[model samples]
Target: MSEQIETWGDLVERAGVGIGGTPSDAPVTKLISAPIPITGSDGTKDFGGCGSGCGCMPQA
Candidate 1:
């Protein structure tokens, strides 16, 4: 006989589709602050201005 599914969590559990990481194993403490530099490149790009000739302007 087939198993009965009551909720989405039950369906996912029955399918056995997961990476095997529980809530307790989550990297909650590994989070970083906004001031942390992710890359070596300094975000100081001066895009002059978004004039009609600017290619960066969204075409709408």
Candidate 2:
């Protein structure tokens, strides 16, 4: 009486293993187009620079 679900369709078909009767609302996530803009000097900053010390701008 044990089963393993491997796909979305299988998940929707199974009952009792989950809420047993109905689907519940899932949380939502909103992504940003770009990294949030940093304002002025945030005091501490990430100086993560290209490991290349060739003095040229790294190809982001």
Candidate 3:
């Protein structure tokens, strides 16, 4: 039998999905606020690691 999941709750209810193993009360904000320094002066200082021109950055 095949089933479609439309929401996070639906996916969590399914078995073998490892939903119960995850902590429900985990902190919402676990991201590190520190800026990662990029070494090597290859004239790549303008390339913002994970922002702007970088593909890792979130697009507005």
Candidate 4:
């Protein structure tokens, strides 16, 4: 089962795409959503960052 699962590094290495420290080379828009600040009823402010994950393309 482990073999069936491919990680981001594996895919990038297989595709020969250099994984730079930045997301400039990404084919897809890495920005899933803009930073959103939410205010609760208690007057507390919360900021949400990008969703968690490697943001890599799925294997075909």
Candidate 5:
């Protein structure tokens, strides 16, 4: 497992593509976030995020 991780690190370094394709390692701080928090949702609309549905609703 360590060997595989080392190989991946070498490629990522050569390709200049950091882990997850992130531009560079920088400390990011979020000041603001979602204003209205989700209290409840029917979640009937399927966004294709899951194979079937959000699990709150039964699958057809």
Candidate 6:
């Protein structure tokens, strides 16, 4: 069986144009950010950071 491929233009044509306009409400004028501290071990757990089943040896 053959499969038919769809395109973005075809989908947009079927859906038609959408309502385009900015919301008539108050907009956010201020921004706030809180940096989170993170800590972890040096990636030398599984295969010494060489991924599982990888044949890598640690430096002497």
Any runs in candidate 3 off by more than 4 Å, and if so which? 16-60
Error of 4 at 11 (Å): 0.4
lDDT of 1 by residue, 1-60 (tens): 345555445555667876354542333232223333323345644433345644443334
Model 3 Cα lDDT, one tens digit per residue, 1-60: 346555444555554465565554433332343344443257664544555655344334
| lDDT (10s digit) by residue, model 4, range 6-49 | 35555466668976674443343234542333444466554232
lDDT of each: 0.44, 0.41, 0.47, 0.44, 0.43, 0.35
TM-score (C-alpha) between model 5 and the true structure: 0.23
Which of candidates 2 and 6 reaches a greater lDDT? Answer: 2
Summarize candidate 2's per-residue lDDT along 1-60 as a digit string, tens digits. 346555444555554355444444432233333343322345444533334543322335
Model 5, span 1-60: residue lDDT tens: 223323544556656875675434433343243333323456534433333434433334
Give model 4's TM-score versus the native structure.
0.25
Q: Name the best candidate (by lDDT).
A: 3
Better of 2 and 4 by lDDT: 4
Per-model C-alpha RMSD? 13.4, 12.8, 9.5, 11.9, 10.4, 16.0
- State the weakest 10-residue window (summed lDDT) of model 4: 51-60
Candidate 2 worst ten-residue window by lDDT:
31-40
For model 6, how does the per-residue alpha-carbon lDDT over 1-60 read when each residue is reduced to its tens digit? 132315444334445853235332323232222122122255434334343433343332
lDDT of 1 at 19: 35
Error of 4 at 42 (Å): 39
State every prediction's TM-score relative to the real structure. 0.25, 0.21, 0.23, 0.25, 0.23, 0.21
As for lDDT, the candidate ahead, 3 or 5, is: 3
